[model samples]
Target: MTASSLTRPSSKASACGCGMKRRAFLRTTFAALCLPSLARGNGPSPLPSFDRCLEHFMAARNIPGGALAILRHGRLVYARGYGWAQREQQIPVQPTTLFRLASLSKPITALAILRLAQARRLSLDEPAFDRLGLAPLPGKTRDPRLEHITIRHLLQHTGGWDRAVSGDPMFMSHPIARACGVPSPPGPRDIIRYMMGRPLDFDPGTRHAYSNFGYCVLGRIIEAVTGHPYETWVRRDLLTPLGIRSMRLGRSQLRNAHPGEAHYYMADNRTAPSVFEEVPSVVPAPYGSFCLEAMDAHGGWLASVVDLMRLSAALPGHGGSLLTAEMWQELVRPPAPPVARDAHGRLNDMYYGCGWLVRPIQTPPGHNIWHSGSLPGTFTFWVILSNGMAWAVLFNQRREANGLPDTEIDGLLHLAAAHVQEWPESDEFPRYYRPSS
Candidate 1:
């Protein structure tokens, strides 16, 4: 693809964000991705401490751009974009700029399935492969346990295929595509058929192991049940209703990036073999190294940090508009034994819920749920605390200069939240969204 094709959406005031003067916007920088502590009220910055922490962290890592958004009691207390959306083009990362969500997309997929179940369209206990009814690609042995896999198992990452034993089929695009006789990168159905030929890493639901392909299957399940493509059903039924219009499944190549999407940057200038091309060629890991399209159900959505918090705002307790209080309660309940507890039958402090990681907190009297997503050029972390505080952090670069994991941002936010003297009373919801009642 040509460099011209790698460009972002038009920079019109209506198309992009606040057409704030470029020179004026940069004045908010305080080193790193200096996004000045900004709020809608135009009063004092909501969280200068948060700005310092985020900025210092980004500067230390040489990250190009990022965004942070916080919500309290369904109100957007804070939202800001740091550094550049496109460093070379001098496009600043706006609060509305889109970023590839990586594994964070899992939570949204889980939400869709839960919505379907709530509406009595499908049951979580229903057999997944039986529902799809696709034959395994002609292979020597098909795991009988595969038929036993359920929708709940897929949501909880308990489906049989373990990346350690069988290798993550999500990344093996080229070989799977060639084997399946499809395009360069195989789609969800093709990947499922490829897995049918291989033995499962373990029995369905016996253990807890993260599986990207499991959610890939969930996307297919959504299609079979809804009579629509995965993205179409999700956007029309779930996201659009919740005032999340810009969220969409992203592409593996930069040439196909959506309008107003932030340009991705690599850590330490890393490069990898392109997954989109028929013949292997080196490309930036964020763009062509892996197939984002094939990872749609698991980690393929692009969204602004604000849109993500809007999702939080719509959930039960926050706004009591999207999900009922009961669904929210059930969403955090741990999976059946061995997955939720240790060998001795003791409950573990942290466990995987439907999509988010769950940890019970005694002080808050409710559980805190969180999830993080990472790809070649993306690193994102978000947590919904038990005390009704939720924050999302997104970066165009996946790693710091020292090679530390992106999850480090979680700790920084934890400290920043602890230090918050007072959260802004102003809410961005009224200004930013128009959710249907």
Candidate 2:
């Protein structure tokens, strides 16, 4: 679609407002144009059947609810909710419904660190432990490599700990709490102390293995440098300027659920030992199977599709990115002599850059950057296409038996995008959105 076609008049309506005049006009116009093209066999149809695509996928996969938002050429072209947000309560998944972002939290945290770096408050190459005012825990074998671990290493997932061998220390909430002499569910600080006493899985910066603990350490570094909680600094420095207000760190207990947050549904509906001993014998995995609060930097964020899109719009290519152009370049630049590759010896098309996954596109002038987040009850996917398009999809229930739901959703989005002959000229943000309180 042409850029002019996507332009829309701005509005000041509340985010949760139900202004549907533009929506109705676009639907009617889109349908009318598609009918003539089919009858004349003029060319491929331009109409994107997003609703049908999403409905079919949700039904086939048994997904209770989801929300989708799409932006083309830096303008929101499609934003809608499907199915239920809270099945038991009969709450529909509107654009305003909050859902756990899981690991997508890393990108937000990474941006905060980059912001600090831009301000000269911290250096990316400095030894992270020294900067954080932390030393190896007293009784554990001190790996000399720990001293060489820099903030860059942590951001790149090269800080040494590997989940395949030593296990992800972030997920071992109970053991970390017990070993650190704390309560049942240890927080980020406790987890860091527990891991510091352990040996590195590999020498720092030698290999690339995805590590949630690495991001956890980055969060600590943010706190150490800023003297403020990670979330607080992020809100002030990164999100506030972007007009995002509702995103917040999620709580593990259902009772503490944020207003308008979707209810989680695990396929098994099984319970695990409570993270808090004082609680019931068991609780739903999303609520207490592990400590969501402790997973703050890596996986504990709750946000709506609108919140995520706002972040995407602020990234480097979208013209309104928060970081300076120089800093933004540094954030996306792949490590020199790229160390990541797959078994076939082909240069891995996709590699982790700062917080997001980077995949170079041969056909497109720019690369694609995206992230996927999955937990017991949540599955989320967000992408910034090389063509200046971005979108986010979030689901309350994840299917264990079905093939990877995010991958299927990814293809579905591409299919829908391919069929779009025209994009709405007006943004629906103000009419249909209600800012998170």
Candidate 3:
């Protein structure tokens, strides 16, 4: 899939639900999944300590605002926001603020697929065409290997589908069908047809490479099996089950979303305020490109730090919601050995597990799995150490394309990882300059 193909529809489409019955079911499920601490907490507020770090970091990098969430042992221990969510409007960011997850939305979509798989609604080995009954594209590659393409292939980024990177013709002022060479940019049904038109980059099981097309296909499959639109199925079945109420799946919903939502920014460089785009709705496809929308299934979920935590904490062995324990294990387990990476000379190898980029971190205690998301003006990362440590960092500035090295953001994350502790402390702040004792 091209970048544009990742856009999801705006939330304008009603999810495939019967009526008040579905709404009541969703509300009850949401109530059941509520986190332990969301409502009441007298523990030291996370704000004061995080405020110091965020203020310093933003000033140092010239980013207007950001948010971070940390969960320890499945409880939301911290959620903090800083800077201007709306710089032009002079609005300040608050802890409850929301932002588009961009590619980070993939994990959520992946979870929805897994939830279906656990229910035996589909199987990993189910052929893509059979699962969705999607037709093959005309004049596309006729490789029989595609018959072996499973839901798992889509999750692991090993589907061998080609991605047209670096352009937004789908977002340009042109017809979607003409912009993309297919007869018509097939809705959820056409993704596989589009892929059938292309030859495999490598045999499906061999090595690994990132392909948004694989994910887009998976999203389509979810909709097909659930008899619901991609966003509705995900929100009703997945997010609601996890008690994540603030998150939304498509751009139309985002545009009409309430005021507390954070706006998106595009950076020209690292040290300046980002140019904001406040479109009423997003075009979802090719997740990282263009603005937000509800067109693509593989990406486009807008969320808050708490919502991301709801997801991040939910995947560690399922713990009685959404996916089953066995399915969650399959999600976190190491991928096929051949695809593991040791590129940094790190002792442990990493692979992509269903819907997640699995990296085994070499920390003193052992290793942890981690994934990071980078969109136009925002970048976020999360790590869940098997030993029960989870930390996340989210930013609202895109510094790399604007002549600023990505190291600036990396540096902040590195600092956070080094200094982060379970206990809040004023002394935890690293002094920018220390006077002589």
Per-candidate Cα lDDT values, in order, are: 0.78, 0.75, 0.55
lDDT score for candidate 3 against the true structure: 0.55
lDDT of 1 by residue, 246-276 (tens): 8998987878889999999876678888877
- Look at candidate 2 and tell me the lDDT of residue 212: 90
Span of ten consecutive residues with least summed lDDT in model 1:
1-10
Runs of candidate 3 exceeding 4 Å displacement: 1-52, 138-141, 162-176, 179-192, 252-258, 269-291, 317-322, 341-348, 360-367, 402-414, 417-437
Give the alpha carbon lDDT tens digit for every residue of 387-407 in model 2.
Answer: 788888888877676553345
Q: Compared to the true structure, candidate 2 yields what TM-score?
A: 0.86
Q: What is the lDDT of residue 67 in candidate 3?
A: 78
Q: If scored against the real structure, what TM-score would every candidate get?
A: 0.88, 0.86, 0.71
Candidate numbers sorted by TM-score from highest down? 1, 2, 3
What CA RMSD would candidate 2 show?
A: 9.4
Clashes counted in candidate 1 amount to: 0
**Which candidate ranks first by TM-score, i.e. highest?**
1
